[model samples]
Target: MDKANQTIQITIDADSGIPIWLQLRNRLVYLISSGGFAPGDKLPTVRELAVSLGINYNTVSKVYQDIERDGYIASFRGRGTFVSDAYLKNEGSAENEADSLIDDFIRQCRELGIPRQEISALVERRLKLTE
Candidate 1:
């Protein structure tokens, strides 16, 4: 099967002690929230995803069920699973929260004695790399 056709990308990290389900949930939430998968985008069936990821089908189903319960996706019988229309409902709030988190990170760095100039220079370097 073509890898590009799969909507979900699952990876097992050998080093991290985190449970596989939590990792899958985090990746999916980040991908959906970041617009990597737009609203209404279809996801692979739980069985197909399990087979592709080499994980148990029950694990894939549980992750999907949890995400759906959290309002991040909608699963319909026969129609398949899809990214929720509500995904973009609070985009502004999400942006504001992200900004606040970054602000907190910078403040913590300063509290830890990271020089302001050094921080600014590092940020500039990162921005330049992205550009």
Candidate 2:
């Protein structure tokens, strides 16, 4: 994975109304699932992430611990933390994978009363801004 020198970017919303730890955890899960990181790829240290997010070190540590407990990542005492293989996406066609994911999201949105047009707008905007 060679993450020792890899650069990772995380966008934080201090005002998202969600707890920072939860937001960070979700971002990490998405990063792992969206192929932004590979299984076994090392993550920033707790201290590093805390400093990066301008939050208390314990907060980042807690998020890491929670995600690890959720099987999204694993920690090796000497080697550091990494994206766990359990969260790894299937290694097949990337386009097909993305389509499947999008379809699932759309299905959930439909059930939640989000119209197709609204979903399309949201997806397009998010893809442009976030991806």
Candidate 3:
């Protein structure tokens, strides 16, 4: 398969029971916010991504449609899809908010008895393995 057809690696817990589409969308948003897919970057088409991930086309399309509605991506007929310009201006603010939210979530996880080192280890492992 072409690299563009490769599946996106999103970190989600299957047992967490979150809907797959939401997980996919949120990870895409995180990528956009982090400049992984910057403004004007073309997104893999629904058919391409679905085949790569071994998911139904309609399922990935649903996520794209919802996110496009949310203003992260702009779709053009017959021209493929690209990230929105609005995303660049708003991404700074969104990244700040996301960072704050993640920090709070980590704190909450600690309060709930999860170890910080475990989280750190997982992040480190992913960083190393993905590289």
> lDDT tens string, model 2, 1-131?
44543434676788887667667877777777777778778889899888777888987888788668656789999999888876444445687558755765786688679998999999889889975
TM-scores for all predictions? 0.62, 0.60, 0.60
lDDT of 3 at 63: 82
Candidate order by lDDT, decreasing, is 1, 2, 3
Q: lDDT of each structure?
A: 0.76, 0.75, 0.72
Instruction: State the lDDT of candidate 3 residue by residue for 13-131, as single tens digits.
Output: 56677656667777887776666777788888889877766667887898898678657899999999888866555555867668755764575568668798887886688789998
List RMSD in Å for every model shown.
8.7, 7.7, 9.1
Top TM-score model: 1
Worst 10 residues of 2 by lDDT: 1-10
In terms of lDDT, the poorest run of 10 residues in model 3 is 1-10
Query: How many pairs of residues in model 2 come into backbone collision?
Result: 0
List candidate 3 stretches off by more than 4 Å. 1-6, 11-14, 88-131
14: Cα error in model 3, Å: 4.2
* Deviation from native of the Cα of residue 2 in model 2, angstroms: 9.1
